[model samples]
Target: MKSNRYIMILFFIVTLLNSSCSDTFVDDIDLKFCGKCAHTGRWTVDSLDFNPCFSTQAECLDWAKKNGYSDRGCVLCN
Candidate 1:
């Protein structure tokens, strides 16, 4: 009887922990939530190469500049 009670308690604890670890709003957050944006691959100029995802126009622009891409090459839409 005592062993059965302990088993049930352990089962309940495991179930609760598993369920609590999950969230209803747990989802992939869209890094690009700002104005018009494009993948880093699109921002190519001269011989520079970029391969990354962005969540803001500024970040893309910054990377582009560092990689030799021009602001004109980037399009931002809000």
Candidate 2:
């Protein structure tokens, strides 16, 4: 019957809409963007220890000290 075809078309349209709607959803994401950088003399020994991209040099140093790093020097970079 024509009603059965109409129902099938509606179901197909609904399925397509549901599948396409998933693209607009976003999952949990943590992002940090600090316009400055920090550097210590430890980069020569270990490149991974040389973490930069901080809001300020002092903040970077504090993080280093808390993590038991001997970062006695700091310099901000762009």
The CA lDDT of each predicted structure is: 0.52, 0.51
Q: Give the CA lDDT, 0 to 100, for residue 69 in model 2.
A: 56
- lDDT string for model 1 (13-65, tens) is 99998988766546644333222224333322222233444555577678767
Candidate 2: misplaced stretches above 4 Å?
1-48
What TM-score would every model get versus the actual structure?
Answer: 0.29, 0.31
**How many residue pairs clash per model?**
2, 0
lDDT of 2 at 54: 49
lDDT of 2 by residue, 13-32 (tens): 99998887764354434222
What's the distance in Å from true for residue 70, model 1?
27
Task: Name the candidate that leads on lDDT.
Answer: 1
